[model samples]
Target: MSSHSKSLGEFDLIERFFKTGANSLRTTADSAIALGIGDDCALIRPPADEEIAITSDMLVEGRHFFAGADPELLGRKALAVNLSDLAAMGAKPLGFTLAIALPMVDKIWLEAFSKGLFAASYDYSCPLIGGDTTAGPLTISITAFGSSPTGKAIRRSGAKAGDDIWVSGTVGDARLALAALRHELNLPNADLQNIAHRMHQPTPRIELGIQLRGIASAALDVSDGLLGDLRHILKQSQVDAEIQLNQLPKSITLQKQGIGIQNQFAASGGDDYELCFTAPSTQREKIHTISKILNLPLTLIGKILPKKDVEVRIHLLDASGIELSNSEAAPFLNSFDHFAS
Candidate 1:
């Protein structure tokens, strides 16, 4: 912890740090939000004919990040991850509430963190509605709210056989950065600098997701590895997938690594907040046009298949189009699990 402000009270801290500028009040005329901060409970109504989408994400000091991590980046990431959930659902941002725990009131950290938080808030047009602040171990929990057309929000359970699986941007750079940071993989300082932002400050594909609303049969944001997150869609939709290992998009930084490392990280490395979605084969032209319009690459990595059994399976294939056995695929099967022994 940095220097502590022993005298700063809770409300005073909120007013000084969180409740100011655009966050001071809901001055902007948003029909969806009826009330904002300074109230016991903030009030929001979904837009007429639209449904609300809500999601929460928590980040702990030691588990999610290192001690004394950059407060600005951490603050941005805390909300960004939650916003990514909204993107996965093809929802439009509305607002968010932040509940934070701190060992003590570190003024410097608060200032930087709040700056970064509001920066994202402004960028995504998601205001800080209300939340709580308390004294405890360093932790950040954010609940973001969004809205989408009623009966039109994309879901994990909508994928069907013959749909094409697509991924926006690239994956595995975040894991690559983590590996280099842990010294598990040797990398140059310059390379680390280039890819560090993938882990630290990820871009949520909000526009791309909204564009994919009617097109995508199912969608999800890749936070906990591509394969692991895709499993959610498979299980929910009662389908399977066959992914070409070579087709999984990789950043130039990750491509420089050995093939084995590249496969493992791209398949199972967490913290890549890219969008992975499934769409019909007929919509290929529209999806490609969306890629051009958004300038975000949407790569077709695989296809959804009929469920073979009760088990939801994702078959992995090599460049030569040969399926790998369980033992051969083990390295890329395990994703980031918070409670694995």
Candidate 2:
């Protein structure tokens, strides 16, 4: 055969190239067929007394992430991003399917990507079930299945007026990472690297979600900006929230950057996988106890108010109950348009 004579088409590519040694994931009965890897439809059975929560996310090139993102991180993020959605619903991750559109067949790229995917899979005790490979501009779409006891899943609609608005951990690290990546501002190398890593490798709050199943009336992972996402909970829960900017969590790295003590980053910037949730005011002590037990920081940032005429307006109040509104200074809920550019 001549060096130029190449006739490996789609089917040949699938059989000869894609279906090599499998990644560390649960296969169908065939070991290689964990969920019918080659068939038109795949089937699997769920355990008794458990319901499945399925979610999908698409990471596009030159969009969701930069083109030169570490392939391993991209792969890990591809699955982790979807898992965050499941976590928001208080589901325990099971397995995931990868649908990748690649520009070419590069073994090194695949190896690194597989490492990233498997690292997270093992960490979460979830596995990769199956996937499809294709040629394109490199978009990775992952659909994940997680489980929860029947009728016990948390939802975004469960929030009620008078519930406490809470957020876990710190926020805006990922956005700060993105800003550093683009060199929009100057920062120390260590902090810059940390921020960038947060943007690339987000840790989904899976355990906390499971722990808060009964307590959280409504919950969601803050993938978008905080103001944008909390507004989502407010709208779905049909309640308004009075956000006291002083109460939001802040990272020391972020604070040192002079973002201010007002918690502006957590209030406006996004990419914090921290769960923003709502619970009745009575659950406050239990929530604090959960945080202490788990060693996770739980900050009560605000409170859900009755569906007032002034909805979606996150008030910035000072110690003396002084309210501040500065739309011109800070554009609330700008992530959609911010990323659109």
Best by TM-score: 1
lDDT of each: 0.87, 0.74
User: Model 1 misses residue 94 by how many Å?
Assistant: 0.3
Question: What TM-score, computed on C-alpha atoms, does each candidate reach?
Answer: 0.94, 0.88
Lowest summed lDDT over 10 consecutive residues: which window, candidate 2?
A: 1-10
Q: What is the lDDT of residue 163 in candidate 2?
A: 88
Candidate 2: residue 329 lDDT (0-100): 27
lDDT of 1 by residue, 227-336 (tens): 99999999999999999989999988899999999998999999999999999999999999999999999999999999998899999999999999999987787776
